[model samples]
Target: MFYAVSAVVLGFLLDLALGDPHWLPHPVRLIGWLIARLEQLIRPVLPKTPRGELLGGILLTLIVVGLSGGVSWCMLHFAAVYLGKLPAYLLEVVMCYQLIAVRSLKAESMRVYRELQKGDLASARIAVSMIVGRDTEKLSPAGVAKAAVETVAENTSDGVAAPLFYLLIGGAPLGFCYKAINTLDSMIGYRNEQYLSFGKFAAKLDDAVNFIPARLCALLMIAAAFFTGLDGPGAFRIWKCDRKNHKSPNSAQTEAACAGALGVQLAGNAFYGGVLFEKPTIGDARRMVIPNDIRLANRLMVVTSLLSLAAFSLMKLLIIFLLH
Candidate 1:
C-alpha cells in the first residue's frame, strides 16, 4: 500500500518533469499497436453483420485489457520475486507514469497558446488540430483558442483524473486496464458507419469507467477555480446546469466547470471529418474566448490533477489503514 501510494506520487512528478519525451517509448503506444494488430486479425475472421462485429469488439476488448493488466501484474510480480522490491517499485512507478497524461496534455495545449501569442492563426490552427478531434481547417482565431481550451477541459477528466482514480484503487495493473479501455475507445469508438456496431462495447465501457472520475474531477476543478480566483460559484452553477451538455455523459463535466470558470461559452458545434456535429452549448457566452484562456485552462487542469492526487492518495491510505 505504501509503495502504491509512493509510486503514484513519484510517477506524477515524473510526468510533470518529463511530459512524455518523444525519445522514450511509451507502453500506451504499444497498446495502441497491439489493438490495431488485433483488430486486423479479429475483423477478418468475423462476419460483416452487426452482431458479428459486436462480438469481435468484445473479444478485442477482452484480449487487450486482459493482456495489458496481466502483463503488468506479471512484470511487477516477477521483478519483486527475483530482483527486489526497489526494482519492482521502480517498474510500478514507470507504469503509473505511463498511465496518466497530465503534463503531456498541458504541453500539447500550450503549443497552440504559443502560436496564438505570435498572431499566427494558421500555426495555431495546426497545433490545435493535433489535440482536437474536430476539423480545424476553417476555424478562426477565436475558434482555435476555444478548441484548445475545450480540449484541455475535457481531457482534465479523461487524461488525468480518471487514470489517477484507477491507479489509487488498484495500482498499475488496474490502471493499465483502464487505459486499454480508453485507448480502444479512442481508436475505434465512434458513431461512424464503420464503428457504430463494432465499437459499442468499448464506448460504453469507457463511459462507465469514467463516470465517477469525471464528476470528481469537475468538483476538484471547481475548487481549483476558487483557489485560482477564476469563478468558483459560476463554475458550480454552470456545472449543475450544463454538466450534461455533451453527447458524451462524461465529456461535459469538466468542460462546463472550465467554461464557467473562464467566463466563456464552449461546445456549441464542431465539424468532424467535414460533417458538423451540433452540440449543445455549455456555459453562457459571458466573454469571448482568448488565447490566454488556454493558459488558464491549463492552470485549472494542473491544479485539479494535484487535488485529485492528494485526495485519492489520502483515500487510498485510509482504506489501507482500515484494511490493516
Candidate 2:
C-alpha cells in the first residue's frame, strides 16, 4: 500500500516534469486499443434478447476491466523489480499523476483567452473548439469565454479529480483502469441514435463511476473558490439551483458551481455535430464573462489541485498511523 501510494505521488511529479510525449507509448492509448479489440470480440456474441445484451455488456465490461488491471499490474510490478526503488517509485507516481490534466487544461483554456484578448475571434473560436465538444463556428467572444470556462470546470472533475480519487482508493493499477474506463466512455458513450443502444453500457457505467467524484470535485471547487476569496455561498447556491440545467446530471453540478463562483452566466444553446442543445442558464446575471474569467478559473483549478493533494497526503498519513 505504501509503495502504491508512493508510486502515485512519483508518477504525478514525473508527469508534471514531462507532459505527454508523442514518441512514447501512452497507456491510455494502449488501453483504448484493448477496448476496441474486446468490443470486436464480443459484438458477434451479443444476444438478440435484451437480457442477453445486458449480460453481454457486463461480460464485455469485465473483460475490459480485467485487461486494464492486468496491464497496469505488469508494468508497475516490472518497474518495481527492474528499476531502482526511487526510480520505480517515481515512475509509478508519474504514471498515476499523468492521468490528471489540470495543467494542460489550464494551458489550453488560457490560450483561448489569449486569442480572445487579441480580438482574434476566429482564432479564439478555434482554440475553444479544441477543448469543447460544442460548435464554435458562430460563437461570440463572450460565448467562447463561457464555453472555455464551463469546460475547465467540468473537466476539473472528469480529467483530474476522478483519477486521483481512484488512486487514493486502490493505487496505480485501479487508477489506470478507472482512466481506461473513462476514456472508453468518452470515445463511445453517446446518446445519438447510432450509439444510444450500442453504447448503453459504456454510458451508464461512466455515469455510475463518475457520480461520487463529480460531487466531490464540486465541493473541492467550492472550497477552492472560498480559499481564493471568491464567493463560496454564491457557488453553492448556483450549484444547488442550476445543477439540473445541463443534460448531464453530474457535469452540470460542477460547472454551475464554477459559474456562480465566478459570477458569470453559462449555458444557453450550443450546437454539436449540427444538432442544437438548449440548456438552462446557470449563475446570476451579474457579470458578463470576459477573458479574465478564464484566468480566474485557472487559478481556482490550481488551488483545487493543491488542496486535493494536501487532503490525500493527510489521509494517507492517518491511515499509516492507524495501521501502526
Candidate 3:
C-alpha cells in the first residue's frame, strides 16, 4: 500500500515535470498490442457460429484478465526490489499520475482555445478534432468550447477517478491491471461491426468495473465545485436530471455535474463518421461556453484529485496504525 500510494504521487509529479514524451514507450500501448495479438491468435481457431463466438469470447476474457493481472504483479514486484523502495515508490507515484489524464486533457483543450484566440476558426476546428469524437468542422466557437469541456468532464472520471479508485482498493498491481483493461477496451471495444463480438467482453467488463468509480467521480466533482465557489445546487440538480443522457449510465453523471458547475450546457447532436447521435443536453443552455471554462474545469479536476489523494493517504495511515 505504501509503495502504491508513493508511486501514484511520484508519477503525478513526474507527469507535471515532463508531460508525455513522444520517444518513451507507453505501457498502455504495449498492453494494447498484446491484446491485439492475442485476439488474432484466437480468431483463427474459433468456429464461425454464435455459440463459438460466445465460448471464444469467454475464453479470451479470462486470458486477458489473467495475463494482465500476472504481468502487473510481476512488474510491481520487480519494481519494488530492483528500483529500491524509495525510488520504486517515487516511480510508482509518477506511474499513478501518468494514469490520470488531467494535464494532457488541459493541454488539448488549451490548443483549441489558443487557436480560437487567434481568430483562426479552421485551425481551431482541427485542434478540437484531436480531442473530441464529434464533428468539429462545422462547430462555432461555443460549439468547440462545449466539446472541449464535455470531453474533459467525462474523461475526468475514466482517466482519473476510476484508476485511483482501483489503486486505493488493491494497490499497484490491481491499478495497473485496471489500466491495462481500460486500454484494451479503448483500443478494441468498439460497437462497430468489426469489434462488436471480438471486444464484447472487454467493453462490458470495463463498464462493470467503472460503475462505482464513475458515481464517486460525480460526487467528487460536485464537492470540488462547491469548494471552488461554483453553483453546487445547480451541479447536483443537473447531474440528477441528465445522469441518464449518456449511452453509458455512469459517464453522464460526472459530465452533467461538470456542465452544471461550469454553468454551460453540454451534449446535443454529435456526428461521428457522418452518422448523427442525438444526445440529451445537460445543465442549463443559457450560459455561453468559453476558453476559461476549460481552465476552470482543469482547476476543479486538480483539486478533486488532490482531495482524493489526501483521503486515501489518511486511510492507509489509519490501516497501518490499526495493524501495528
Candidate 4:
C-alpha cells in the first residue's frame, strides 16, 4: 500500500519535471500499434456486416485490455519475486509516470500558444491541428486559440485525472488497462461511415470508463477555479447548465467549467475531415477567447491535477486504513 501511494506521487512529479520525450518508447504508442494490427487482422476475418464488425471490435477491446493489464501485472509480480520490492516499486513508478500526460498536454498546447504569440497564424493552425481532431487549415487566430484552449480543457479530464483515478484504484496494471481502452478509442472510435459500427464498442466503453472521472474532474476544476481566482461560481453555474453541450456524454464537463472559468464561449461548430460538425456552444460569450487563455487553461489543468492526486491519494489511504 505504501509503495503504491509513493509510486503515484513520484510518478506525477517525474512527469512534471520531464514531460514525455519523443525519444522515449511509450507504452501508449505500443498499445496503439497493437490496436492497429489487431484491427487489420480482425477486419479481414470478420464478415462485412454491422454485427460482425461490432463483434470484432469487442474482441479486440478485450484482448488489448486483458493483455495490457495482464502483462503489467506479470512484470511487477516477476520483479518483486526475482529482484526486490525496490525494483518492483521503481518499475511501477515508470509505468505510472507513462500513464498520466498533463505535462505533455501543456507542452503541446503551448506550441500553439507560442505560435500565436508570434502572430504566425499558419504555424499556429498547424500547431493546434496536432492536438485536436478538427480541421485547422482555415482557422482564424481566435479559432486556433480556442482550439488549443478547448483541447487543454477537455484533456484535463482525459489525459490527467482519469489515469490518476485508475492508478489510485488499482495501481499501474489498471492504469495500463485504462490507457489501452483510451488508445483503442482514439484510433478507431469514430462516427464516420467506415467506423460507425466497428468502433461502437470502443466508443461506448470509453464513455463508460470516463463517466465518473469526467464529472469528478469538472467539479475539481471548479474548485481549482476558485483557488486560482477564476470565476468559481460561474464555473459551477455554467457546468450545471452546459455540461451536456457535447455529443459525447463526458467531453463537455471540463470544457464547460473551463469556458465559464475563463469567461468565454467554446465549441460551436467545427470542421473534421472537411466535414462540418455542428457542435453546440458551451458557456456564455462573456468575452472572446484569447491566446493567453491557453496559459490560463494550462494553469487550471495543473491545479486540477494536483488536487486530484491529493484527493485520490487520501482516498486510497483511507481504504487501506479501513481494510486494516
Candidate 5:
C-alpha cells in the first residue's frame, strides 16, 4: 500500500515536471497504432450492416482493453517476481506518469496561446489545428482562441480527469484501458457516413466510461476557478444552464463551466471537413473569447489537475486503509 501510494504521488510529480517527453514511448500512441491496424482488418470482415459493425466494435474494444490490462499486469508481475518489489514499484510509477496527462495538455494549449500572442493568426491556426477537429484555415483571431479554449475545456475532462479517476480506482492498467477507449473514440468515433455505424459502439463506450468522470471534472474545475480567482459563481450557473449544449453527453459539461468561468461564449457554427456545423452555443457571451482567455483556461486546468492529483491520492489512501 505504501509503494502504491508513493507511486501515485511520484507519478503526479513526474507528469508536472516532465509532461510527456517527445523521446519517451507513450502507451496511448501504441494503442492508437494497434486500433488503426485492427480496424483495417476487422472492418472488411464484417458486413456494412449495423449489427455487423456493432459486433466488430465490441470485439475491438474487448481485444484492445483486455490486451492493455493483461500486458500491464503481466509486466508488473514478472518484474516483481524477477527483480524485486522496489523495481516493479518504480516501473509502476513510470506507467502512472505516462498514463495521466495534465502538463502535456496545458503545454499544447500554451503553444496556441504563444502563437496567438505574436499576432500570427496563420501560425496560431496551425497550432490550434493540432488540438481541435474543426477547420482552422479561415478562423478569426477570436475564433482561434475560442477553439483553443474549447479544446482545453473538453480535454480537461477527457485527458486529465478521466485518466486520474481510473488510475486512482485501479492503477496503471485501468488507466491505460481508459486511454484505449479514448483513442478509439478520437480516431473513428464520428457521425460521418463512414463511421456512423462502425464507430457507434466506440462512441457509446467512451461516453459510458466518461459519464461520471466528465461531471466530476466540471465540479473540480469550478472549485479550481474559485481558488484561482476566476468567476466561480458564473461557472456554476452557466454549467447548470448550458451543460448539455454539446451533442455528446459529456463534452459540454466542462466546456460550459469553462465558458462561464472565463465569461465568454463558445461553440457556435464551425467548419469541419469544409462543411459548416452549427453547434449549439454554450454560456452567455458576457465577453468575447480572446487569446488571453487561453492562458486563463490553462490556469484553471492546471489548478484543477493539481487538485485532482491531491484529492485522488487522499482517496487512494482512504481506500487502502479501509481495505486493510
Candidate 6:
C-alpha cells in the first residue's frame, strides 16, 4: 500500500517533469491503433443498418475495453509475481506516469498562451488548434485565449483527474482502462452524421465514466481557486448556474467553474468542420479572456492535481491503517 501511494505520487511528479515525451511509446497510442484495426475489421462486416450499427458499436467497445484491461492486468500480474517488488513498483510508476497528462495538458495550452503573448494571432491559432477540436483558423486573439482556457478547464477532468481517480481506486490497469475509454471517445466519439449511431456507445460510455470525475474536478477547482487567491464564491455560483450550459453532460462542469474563477466568458461559438456552432455562453462576461488567464488556468490545474494527490494518498493510508 505504501508503494502504491508512493508510485502514484511519483508518477505525477514525473509527468510534470517529463510531459508525454514523444519518444516513449504510449499505451493510448497502441490502443488507438487496435481500435482503428478492429473497427475496420468489424465495422465492415456489420451491416449498415441502425440495429447493426448499435450491435457493432457495443461489440467494438466490449472488445476494446475488455482486451485492454485484461492484457494490462496480466502484464502487471506477471511483473509483480516474477520480478521483485521494487521492479513492480517501478513498473507501476512508469505506467501511471504514462497514463496521466498533467504536464502535457498544461504544456500544450501554454504554447497557445505564449503564442498569444507574441501577438501572433496566426501562430496562436495554430497552437490552440493543436489542443482543441474546434476550428482555429478563423479565431481572433481572444477566441484563441478562450479556446485554450476552455481546453485547460474541461480537460482538467478528462486528461488528469479522471485517470488519477481510477488509479487511486484500482491501479495502473484501471487507469489505463480509463484512458482507453477516453481515447475512444476522443477518436471516434462524435455526433456527426457518420458517427452518430456508430459512435453512440463509446460516447455514452465515456459520459458515464466521466460523470463523477467531472463533478469532482469542478469542486477541486473551486477549492483550488480559494487557495490560489481566485474567486471561489463566484466560481461556485457560476458553476451551479452554468455548469450545464454546454450540450455535453460533463464538459461544462469544470469550464463554468474556470470561467467564473477567471472572470471570463467561455463557449460562445466555434467552428467545427466548417460549421459554426452557437454554443451557450458560460459565466458572465465580467472581463475578456487575457493571455494571463492561461497561466492562471494552468496554476489552478496544478494546485488541483497536488491537492487531489494528497487527498487520495491520505485516504489510501487511512484504509491501510484501518484494515490492519
How accurate locally is residue 294 in candidate 4, as Cα lDDT from 0 to 100? 97
How do all models score by TM-score? 0.99, 0.89, 0.90, 0.99, 0.97, 0.97
The stretch of ten residues in a row with the least summed lDDT in candidate 5 is 1-10
Q: Which 10 consecutive positions of candidate 1 have the poorest summed lDDT? A: 94-103
RMSD of candidate 5 to the truth, in angstroms, is: 1.2
**lDDT by residue (tens digit), candidate 6, 201-244:** 99999999999989988999999999999999989999999999
Lowest summed-lDDT stretch of 10 residues in model 6? Answer: 307-316
Tens-digit per-residue lDDT, 59-126, candidate 3: 77677767777876777678778887766565556556666666777788888888878888889899
lDDT tens digits by residue: candidate 2, 1-324 = 577666656655665567566686777887788777877777678766656655655676677777787777787788878886776666667678668777678889999999999999999999999999888999989999999998888888888778877887777777877887787677667777655555678778888888988888888889998999888998998988998887776888788879888988988778999899776788887978998999988888778776776677567768977999
> Local error of candidate 1 at 124, Å?
0.8
**What is candidate 1's lDDT per residue for 1-324, written digit by digit as tens?**
788999999999999988898999999999999999999999999999999999999999999999999999999999999999999999999989988899899999999999999999889999999998899999999999999999999999989899999999999999999999999999999999999989999999999999999999999999999989999999999999999988899999999999999999999988999998888999999889999999999999999999999999999999999999
Segments of candidate 4 deviating more than 4 angstroms: none
**For model 1, what is the error of residue 121's alpha carbon versus the real structure, in angstroms, after optimal superposition?**
1.1
- 169-247, model 4: which lDDT tens digit per residue? 9999999999999888898899988889889999999999999999999999999999999999989999999999998
After superposing candidate 6, which stretches have Cα over 4 Å from the reference? none
| Model 4 residue 165 CA deviation in Å | 0.3
Record all residue pairs in model 5 with backbone atoms less than 3 Å apart, i.e. clashing.
none
The 10 consecutive residues of candidate 4 with the worst lDDT sum are 1-10
Model 5 TM-score relative to the real fold: 0.97
Can you write out model 5's per-residue Cα lDDT over 211-243, one digit (the tens) per residue?
999998899999998999999999999999999
Residue 137 lDDT, candidate 2, scale 0-100 = 97
What is residue 306's positional error in candidate 1, in angstroms? 0.5
Cα lDDT over the full model 5: 0.89
